[model samples]
Target chain A: MRTSKKYIVTGLFLILLIILLSCELMLGSVYIPAQNVFSVLTNNEHQNEVWNTIILQSRLPRALGAIIAGASLSVSGLLMQVLFRNPLASPYILGISSGAGLGVALITLGSVGIGFTFVPNGLSLVASAMLGALLVFSIVFFISLKVKDVMTLLIAGVLIGSIANAVVNIIQLHASALAVKTFVLWTLASLDQLEMTDIKLLYIICPLTLIGSFLLSKQLNALLMGEKYARSVGVNILLSRILIILFSGILAASITAFCGPIGFIGIMVPHIVRIIFRTNHHKLLILFSVLIGSCTLLAADLMAHYFITSVSLPINAITALIGIPVILWLLLGKKDISKTI
Target chain B: MHTILEIKNIDVSYKQQKVLENGSLTLKESTLTALLGRNGSGKSTLLNTISGFLKPTKGEILVSGVNIYKSNPATRARLISYLESTPLSPQNISVKELVAFGRYPYLDLFTSLSESDLTIIHSALFQCGLSQFSDRFFNELSDGEKQKVFIARAIAQNTPLIILDEPTSHLDFIARREIINLLKTLCLKENKTIFFSSHEPELCVELADRFVVTANHTFSEVNKTEVLKTLINS
Candidate 1:
């Protein structure tokens, strides 16, 4: 029987999430009082100009950016885990991020000869990243159809990653030092420099994609077993797989497009939730993954925000510090995850 | 006896290699049938075809006297549940939580668990002797315990017919007999038709109400006594 304690744990997690998210909004470079923050939120006409700009222009967008990035990456990771039925599988595992890096490279290199005049200089780079993520998504999706084995798909993913890295390096070699620096900075994956427009675009896309993922929770849970098991459970394997890939592509592409390719949070949050709740219940996992992801990213973002007085660290660096250890612990515990194959 | 399933002249292939040719079988309501076969003998293939996981190249799989291939898969799942030989054990899931997944076919999208669904899950856990271990992590359980948890999930599906591939392979001899007896009790008490493939020919003959033997990629029915004899001779 379910207990009151379970409800308490869930409530506690929610409270922790709220505290972290609020701290994310309040604890930036220019500090604002709690009362002033509330007034800026509610009394729009009466608030101070500096407070209004900080809350509206800087803090709100940054908080939203962190949320969108976190949810997308975590859910993307969850979907890949189900699609390949591997604990280590993630959206970044297929080398899509590296491919997106290549796309960003092409755009940053100032290839005016390429088509699409509608894309302006900065936006073109983002679009190229999206296209790169899409291309990688298609390749991995296609390979999965041919190879039923998860390990084979992983091998293919590694091979694709290697090839994509080679291409990215080739692009780097031809580009100028300044462009290479710009590309390298982007690859570090930061949460800063998010404009209001970028926030709006993410707001529009990420939630819609997340809703689509929510609808496919049962299907994803079924896929945790193999395809035959999924089908026997009444899941349409083809349709579900397509939807998963599509949603995952949007999330991965969005993060890579705006914030660069951040890893670990995507791959780690679902595993964390699985460990906490002791269930792959999609309904629970889907909801909690978003929450845990937001909390994890916000905590990491805080570290990035306050770690150095002189300079802010990239978000991915903080995540790597936290995530790698959990992974190491899982591996060292002898869980026999690889034996699933 | 009312017929629940009919497999008519089924020919199945994996890409180009033919796996099952003109395979056919019929199942009556409230019967327990054991599927016996060697490795690569198309036993799992037949189960897949029958469950609508794979469409046979040339044949019809009918469930509840309706061709399952024609019925939309969601509806077919409402009638049949198939457990794979080596299913992925969700690491963090408890026995109770995994069994609750069986209600997926009954509930609509966005519909949370109703009281009936909880009741079914509770009963399944009880039947599979997992009532006491409902909170234990699935990965922490022994292989025999995990097999019972899987059976509990199938039981929670609440379908009239259930299919399993090699359900007893994970258990020791004593645990194997206990699971077999548990399955037999389910068939008798609930009037649910059960079908599972097993390598233990003697166990199948002793336990199952009917025997379905797959030899040389072909399936045929044999009397329990004859199946026992065949096992001895082979």
Candidate 2:
């Protein structure tokens, strides 16, 4: 009975997400009728092949891309914040995303001028990105075992991230202008590159990871209290720590592989959910987070789409632009974020 | 009286600096215990060791004759509930939900509250006189009320033994008295073994049924008046 309100709130968020999805389909560079968008989505054959390709191949995947990317970034942000016990922690800022970016960089830059003409498709980049993220994740994961301090891991992640960034910069310096330009564009972060195949892959990884987070909801709740408090209550602190790092790493790495390092969704979305839901149940919070995160990136995608019809802006820049202010307001708005979680 | 807790010759050290050595003590069931010592007397360390957070350099702790360190966290949690001094009050959690975390040991990750689990949570809240405050945010409660919430969480754990490093360290005089009386009530009414560490030996001597003093690397029993005199002179 008490949970009825969360159901209503989540239901509303889902509705908002659907409405935004419809808007995304209708409001791209070439506007199609709301009716045609529906017919195409329902898998009905339309008369015009070009309009069908634009709808089925381009707009649909891009919109799904925004939804999955938003959800993944926000959920991982929630993980990082709880893991570090700091409200400011995010996958992008923590260098988790940069670790993925490094993976992309090694592949994107290293093969330059070698006459290796491999198609740099979404699947390949995603694989490279996942590899890079897992590499840094393992380092942080093992260190978490010895350190047992989230603050230390936070510092280590940032340091490892910086080292990775420095290395990427060196690679860029030696790389050809074309290679460097492509790497820079990837860092800008966009949803345009995602295809239906990439979206299908994410449909598996993202949902599974979200479910994994839901299963560990109790441990995350324990963690929000503090390590000693959690352990005293029978939570396996070390196991929980390792699992959290891996889960967040996988979530971040998957998104970075697909869409580059989309900034601030993780930090910004969880805070918004906290402010709205105002409850501490991670299961419920995770649900609210995924919904709100889905809506957020859709809105961000729309904003990027409409910012200038001539050329779209990077989704990463838009999220940071929106995210920084929300953080500022949360800190200044008497939100009581200074409490342990 | 049955021995509910046995701390056997524990040698606890922090970074090679031994704080307690060769300390052996047994506490009986249904008694209020106060661990008294001067500053840096290893009272917290001993409590943490007993709670299974710290492994002693050489000794084992037994809860109801079972070696706690050899047991799993969930099993140990069912046997003993522990509270740290100055516990962090996580924001955005209601007092009721916070107390429900106590039932964690009995339930799995996917299990929702059964009828009896809800009953126990309500009882823990009722025992602490927090029925009206159950829905309030834990961080918004007053200092004394917050401390009672912590105790209520431990109570809801339904463990035989509850250990606290310092429950009243941050309370005012009236709050301190209220907490002491509450602990006394828990021992009497609920028949729970409540062992707590405190620097306030004078207040503790008046309240506790048993006094265990730690000084000069040893633990020895003392009477109420003797505890007061020893703490004052030392």
Candidate 3:
């Protein structure tokens, strides 16, 4: 009975993801018809050249970016929560994204102050972002080793994020107007700005790391009981910890490098998946998190694009608006949130 | 019965401070050994060292005549199953699912649970008298029930030897008696070696086959008469 229920729920999530993906491709500024979007996607000859260009160039890449970012962040969030054994843990809440943001900020804004005229290319941004994320994650990991209490580590992550944000703000103060503007817009976070080349890079990095996370499911299941128990079951705790950090760091860093620091999706999606599935098994959790995460971001991106006719709101704002309430509800509804994880 | 677990003169320490020095004990198969110690008496440390969680500074532990420290984690896991006091009660995990975690060491990364693995899990549940509670969430169970679930998990691991830290600490009187009886059954019926630390020596004196007391930074096995005299005096 449980097996059949899982299959049905998994199928439903897949269908929802498809519907959202189609809506993301169809509804946009120009409002291309669903059939036209389908034809364009299928490589059929469309009558309107402008519609084809918009569907292929703008909507397709943006939709794909939403899927990648959503799945990557959500999986990373689930990893963090399990690793730390804290329900509030996520890539954004633990300051990993801010670390990536700081990396991007240094490259984009700090170059203006240094007067080096350095070009912020895709490779440079990705490298810096990953370095920053790894740096913060290493600190968090070290702190976790020293302190058994996860709440302290959460606080440390927030403080580290604050420090990174402060550094970004200081660099912005010294940067040129153009550099500051670009950095600010990046902080607002968007999916429409990613080029096809960037999408190709994301496709390589995110899917491989996601697969890596899936492969670690057994270790993760062992970890769900705690470190000592996991070790008793022959899990190499140190190696598992390092691999989890590496995978999550790369996932969060690559997405932030491409689409800015998208928040809430990582932390929010896993909890939703856990509630819907009513199981703590990582294999099922990781699969549904990916599907549900993709659907969520696609819907959020759609709202961000067409919520208001005149002004295009930041994707960050829409996600925050959707995510904060869920977080609040999670906090208020549970007397002790840590028990839920 | 043959000696299944042999601990040579081993020193256990936390950081640089030594806790147990030259601690040694040996246990035969199918016997229940109860470890009695006062608060902060290094019983847990000794248990951990024996279970391969801590590296003893100057000795070797052998399970079935194989030096456990020289073996890999998988070998050690198969040799000994350990249950910590107050295990985490993870939410949304069913009793059967948690017990299935015991089969992790036997499974490769890509392989799912085979028929034999499921059989072991079901038998463990049945042994613990938790067959009806297999579908319930772990966190929702009462404290005594949760402890049984953990024991069931250890049983599912299918190890020859099992060690537990303060197994009856938080349990009520009836629950504690039930647990002690259950551990006794596990030893005699399942033919497994059981070692567990406990504060209540009186409750264990009736069922325990042997007693090892931790005091004065060392461990020593005492016969029942001596332990009874000590208990009566203290």
On DockQ, the candidate that comes out on top is: 3
List TM-score per model, in order.
Answer: 0.89, 0.95, 0.93
lDDT of 3 by residue, B67-149 (tens): 98899888888889999987888888899999999999899878989999999999999999999999998888998999999
Off by over 4 Å in 2: A1-5, A112-121
2 versus 3: better TM-score goes to: 2
Query: Whole-model Cα lDDT per candidate?
Result: 0.80, 0.85, 0.86
Q: Estimate, for each residue in A277-329, the C-alpha lDDT of model 2 and write its tens digit.
A: 78778987888788899999999898898768778898888887876787678
Candidate 3: misplaced stretches above 4 Å? A93-95, A116-163, A309-311, A327-335, B231-234
> Largest TM-score belongs to which candidate?
2
B113 in model 2: Cα distance from truth in Å?
Answer: 1.8
Which residue pairs in candidate 2 collide? Answer: none
The 10-residue segment with the lowest total lDDT in model 2 chain A: A112-121
Evaluated against the true structure, the overall lDDT of model 2 is 0.85
